[model samples]
Target chain A: MSAQDEGRPIQSSTPDGAAAIGRHAIRTEALSKDFTLHLQGGLRIPVLRDVDLAVAPGECVALAGPSGAGKSTLMRCLYGNYGAGSGHVWVRHDGRDVDITNADAREVRAVRRDTLGYVSQFLRVIPRVPTQQIVAEPLMARGVPREDAMAHAAALLSRLNLPATLHGLPPATFSGGEQQRVNLARGFAPGYPVLLLDEPTASLDAANRDVVVALIAEAKRAGTAIIGIFHDTEVRDRVADRLYEVAPLQDAA
Target chain B: MSALLTAEGLHLHFGKVAALDDVALEIHPGEVVAIVGESGSGKTTLLRVLAGMMAPQAGQVLYAGEDVHAMGEAARRRLMRSDWGFVHQNPRDGLRLRVSAGGNVGERLMAAGARHYGDIRAEATEWLKRVEIDPARIDDMPLQFSGGMQQRLQIARTLVTRPKLVFMDEPTGGLDVSVQARLLDLIRALVAELGLAVLIVTHDIAAARLLAHRMLVMRRGQVVEQGLTDRVLDDPQHPYTQLLVSSVLAA
Candidate 1:
């Protein structure tokens, strides 16, 4: 699972192939991000400042705060969608140590394809592409045969309650809830080491929400590191092993 | 203590069954009291009575020592406009479905005699930000919002006028479990910031524990128990209260 060192303080272990060293699937040391307000005469606004966080294998860390507290911004930074202005976002990917904040495009793409799963708030699939194929792309990229990938895709979609007939159709016209389920299926299909979830069940009904809750539990049990922003407290309480409160920069002491 | 609102000897009947029976309570300014009960326990009926939305068969609801049921229609309407706010279980019930998200909040401001389009729009934007909604979505219709977003918009609509007393009936009901906590946190923060007297009717005891200073337990149209939120939840004297607390914890 992970190597141990006295100074690092080895707390526990996970299943095989979880993390490279320290069992820390994700770690951010003094991470900071800021935005230039061009409309306001180039004024700079601090989004996250001097923030330190860590997520171990087999644990879910929930980001809790009021909206506009930079929760989503931090998630984007962790997934390499946004760069960190300073500090580091160290992630364990496929037995390699990758720094997401300043990683080159090729490195970021490799880590994203091989070890990270992200379910953003909205679905963005190529137009007219079959939903099943889009969901299967992750596994296929990792060298799983097309047939095997499609089979896994079908299973995951079915588990998420997506109808069988709709698998071959594009998800562009699907309802919001349906689109969200499709997004979840694709993110989970890869069985990646880490998962970044943003309001994964935001539009889902109670029944579908329970399915997602179960999925999160399974991922944690499988030793996946999960960093999620759940505006829904119930799901956070059910899945999160710990919470990291992201205070607004103005409120930081 | 000078109670801001009080109810006495409240009794109501709907067809063959009693909706509320001999209910009495008092609310002070800058306090939050939560009413918890199962469906058909007459929690909503009691809230409606205290908010002056309905009159009981025999009882008196007083606001600032004045009789609510005895007020003239215009005066009652004015009282609701100026000093009272109501948050329905469904955001659609409390919000103007056809209006823009900002327009809904603006209407409340207009009712309270705010004019000048620039100032009203600015205030609306401010309130939306306070409720954790993106101010850039101010012009969007409430119909386009998600359930959680719509509920937050409904809150901004009700509180924009700075009402002295607010009545919320299952404010966080109909929302997914994950979205409920964020809304509750916003409501709790706003309630404390404004020091608005709130009487929240909910089935969620956890929400009560988070937001309310006092707790009221209702059963079969009567007050079964009442005390401070922590005390009543920690050591329940009534069997129904004990069951309710345990059920929430079990869930």
Candidate 2:
């Protein structure tokens, strides 16, 4: 289904300018993203076109689509990891609305620290850093006392079922499942107001997957706006309050 | 079905503060019940009382239809060792940090009368794997595991005996979102598969919703609402419950 097929974008007009993103925890208005194929004679391939989405506190919105449908691209665009082609992607950060597409680097970093948390499929480990310290770095950055932060990180690792013997070792040599757990621990450590989960449970087993689902439910109840891409239908059904279809560009055409 | 556990006219006091007042409840076989309330609501006191960890000034806690308090000290200890599991809020409270991870799991098997060392070790390894820990790390001490791992190890130790009933006090408290999430899932699955009765004390309504079949919403040491978990959470009739449900959403 195309964006047009999923009912009109529910954006209300504001007197100050375009629709206010402050009205929701996360909102994107007419977001258009295109990737340039410089290798193929600069082909301007459109990824997300005129996409509008709003996620409210205590709500979960699942993005559903096939591979190569730009769902991940859209998530990156909202996180400012990928620049948009046109339109606004606004996030409520520190009690104010900041357009991710236009926000400066500092503003974007602040939002990442205080307002948003993203959990991807892989862990980005700094070689030689202890697993406990890696998870603690973010909390330390936010001014948590060093001992308290490390304790919290250790607690998080335990929850992920990572054995205690590996606490002092780096995650670089860990298995895929272990690395994924580390990444999840970090993403969930911050308790950001909005969480973006991209198959957070992809490498997890039934036990771990259930944990991720419970975590998402708790976050929603705590008033965190969550946008996640869960390929597993059962997981999506359990956690998502609504579905937002991201039709491929070819389908839109 | 017969009651697996019961409490009658429970009362306790901490100096001038009445921690519990005329509290009463029961649990049936294979039933998962949750006690939820704000801090200082005496939910924890009720859990401790039922677990026979703390003596109540007035009232009786019955396990298998007998007064748990009236039982001989050795009998109570044996009952706790063989048929009951306790998962504390802090993993450290339940785990022996000095013991090797496998030893921690093996201890329970031994309590259940597993005589052979080789068999005890194998069973410990098996339980460790069941809780998603790598069995190869069986010799590692609980002191070395992360907080989440320690909690899982504690769970393994508690459930290794396949106890008929478990008492949990905020089983997922203080852990990160994802970790707590997984633990809740583990608890739910274990409770179902083992057909074990559980009485959990938690302030998290979401935890109650996911794991409990019935819920007791307490205020000032009294249950203001009690019913099927879905009924109470979805359409709470009590004013305090309404405020709690809405406040949790707004937070």
Candidate 3:
């Protein structure tokens, strides 16, 4: 069904300016994604069924489930990393709404660049790039000046307790905890209102997990809306203002 | 009753940073000793050193009264192959992800040159059953399993070889509350049943209380406290140990 059919009005404001004042950051209705896994010669498997979710401004929602529950797939769909077979994803900005699901490749790229921040279970860091540069890339992509972005990145690293000397070094040499902090910093660098995280603290120890939890709380306080997939109970208990579980979509056989 | 592993004044250095300093520990047969500490407290380094994965700059590791560090490469390899099982904080590190559940569990036997396919498959099934994984899913890939199931599979893989000494680094680190409890119970039961000596490194005092007979608390690469688990956790002597106990208790 179309978003209008589901009673969601078409928003008229831009998402980039939506953060200044509180607004619904993510709205979805009847969202669905399907993947065909060829079994033998002519079989297909539907990975995700019709799903609906919504996140208001400054909300933190936790998604939980077993390995094949499609939690990650749902996050991918929300962040425009994957296309939905049917449904609408709306991110409201400045009283206007962007239909992320129906956007073309270039439009989706623009939406992801300006409005969405994502962190996956395994962090991907570029070789030879300083932590500052890595964290600043999102802001740079959003058209923030290089110097200002670097300053913002440095401030974030310091707040996260990353060593000053290591700021210019490659993230590969940092400890697992430090690298995760960098990934988080990059996700928040552009100040996007919507953040998507997948098992952010699964690889970290207790102390490091606490640090990331505190960061998530801080982000919410700063008015960022977060939707994350978590396997750690402590993290979900500590951070989730709301929680949902993704179950396997029934087969069409 | 014999000392299966011993460390004397173990010192490890990562560049200029001292990771372990004058550390000493001992593991005897059928005993479970837990090392408890905060992150960056050298607990993992100590375990790696004892497992012979890292060399100590000054100090000695003795395996059954022989200097393990001094052993020839072939002998050391043989000792590791026959006597030791090490579990990483992340099960993915301990498991072969691309392979099926059966292959992951059967590999240790295969590495030891157990070529009988029937025997390997039978042994893998037995181990999987031991770890509470359904035998019906033995052909599935590791990627298809849940977090707790993957960890159970890792345990099955490591224990299939029936090594005498098992070193587990945060075996329950990433599991959910109920899953962690179950996995801990499984480990405790299996350790008792097999009379396996375990040296587990963990930060959770509650887990240590449940699984360990003895406990060591480390800080800044030094062992601040070591004693029976109840004594150390109930009435910690060292300030660092006390802090750790209280922190976990508070949680």
Candidate 4:
């Protein structure tokens, strides 16, 4: 597909689309998304339409939109959690822009392992896995030794205010805030070049929320490009460089 | 990377029931693929067909670009002995219950042409430790071991040959939850440590989530859904898949 695109003249709406494609950390080209309700007689519900989003290295863009305006949908599309209805979702992985929309499973997985990281609102609890191991898994998958990964996980958990005692136990028994901290630690542990955070602070207390803000700031200074959905205005203001509004479509009722 | 094993258009019938219906999949090197479904979903049948224990009436199973069904009986058996392994749900089926733990593991090494008794025993002892079994129990018969130990022993025996691909049919089935967790963790670590490709069929979604990178949701012998494990579990698109995910009791 990229080969075919290279042969055709690059036609993009944004003046910098061609230039940004070469330099940006991550970007979308006329991206669109929708859902089909199989139970509801296959009714199609359109979400995002022609979303041309781009994030440069070291910058943070927070998605701003009303509930049901497709904010989370857009974030999932950028992270390849949701397949795009049309157009390309390009991510710079290993020094090349990979279109996540059409990339093979292995290629997408490779990009996710090294370049893209996402911290959803809730932790997908792995039964019986210790909290520290949960956070350390991404690092281990990326080839970090187990001992080093565990230490990195512990350090991040401590920074997030999760007690050391809880780190040895499964996060299934932890409070919502504690589990969220574990999720945050795991996502941020990899220091991915492009991150999609869906309300990273939604379940956190003020103190831990501040720690997250600090983590995001630290990540940004290290040349990471982050796209996030922050309901907490204070935290959003502290970490986000700008807001990208996802306006609701008018055609669907 | 090319797939270590691939099956296409697999079709089988048990009387009026379609035990396997047009099933197709590929297992790449060092990747874990789980087949998940309720009872009688033909997950075990799929595993058996893929491992060459059972043949589908239609479709082809390929190992390294060679047709599994087309291979000579001796050649296929040799492949199972050296390049592939199978872990039965019951350890008794996979292991020689009368044989000592070390002997059980050593049998595979001997089958692969190891004639030196000391070398075979040494490798078996090492594999025993790798699977978390006490090396001291190397001389103990498998019947004397606990259910979990027997399962671990079965694993050790299969892995002794360093098979590039393994087929596991409900490896953690019928064990206590705690024991199952430990075994699952051991299997996860070993798979990573050795970079072995695994095809696991299980009814346990939790086990699938813990071990498999990709999952195929089977129902009535058909692959109703398939994708990255977390994606299929977290955001199930098919109604059957949604029901399967929602039906799991919270742990």
- The numbered model that scores best in lDDT is 4
Question: Share of real contacts kept by model 2?
Answer: 0.00
Pitting candidate 1 against candidate 3, the one with the higher lDDT is: 1
Q: Compose the digit string of candidate 2's lDDT tens values, residues B1-251.
A: 56889888899999888888777787888788899989999999899889888899999999988889889788889988999999999999998888899999898788789999999998998898888899999999998998888999999999999999999999889898778877876787688668899999998887787778778888777777665564456545455666677667521
Better of 2 and 4 by lDDT: 4
Badly placed stretches (over 4 Å) of model 4 are A1-20, A40-43, A163-167, A250-253
Tens-digit per-residue lDDT, B7-100, candidate 3:
9999988887778988887788878899989899999999988988888999999998989888877887887667888888898999998999
Question: Where in model 1 is the C-alpha error above 4 Å?
Answer: A1-253
lDDT per residue for candidate 4 within B103-196, as digits (tens), equals: 9999999999999999999999999999889999999999999999999999999998999999999999999998998899888888987889
Kindly provide the TM-score of model 3 when superposed on the true structure, using C-alpha atoms.
0.49
Candidate 2 lDDT over A1-253, as tens digits, reads: 2211211121222224545555499999899988654344556788899999999998999999999999998888777666567898788876667777656433465678788888877675434558988788778768788899999999888888887899899887998989988988898887888999988888889988888888888888899999999999899999999999999999989
For A1-253, candidate 4 gives per-residue lDDT tens digits of 2212211121222223445475589999899887766556767888888899889999999999889999988888787676677898888888667788666555677889999999998887546779999999889999999999999999999999988988999887788898899999999999999988999999888899899999999999999999999999999999999999889987433
lDDT of 1 at B38: 96
DockQ of each: 0.01, 0.01, 0.01, 0.21
The worst-scoring run of ten residues by lDDT in candidate 2 chain B lies at B230-239
Query: Which pairs of residues have clashing backbones in candidate 1?
Result: A231-B178, A232-B178, A232-B179, A233-B178
* Runs off by more than 4 Å, candidate 3: A1-253
lDDT of 1 by residue, B114-187 (tens): 99999999999999999889999999999999999999998999899999999999998989886887788678
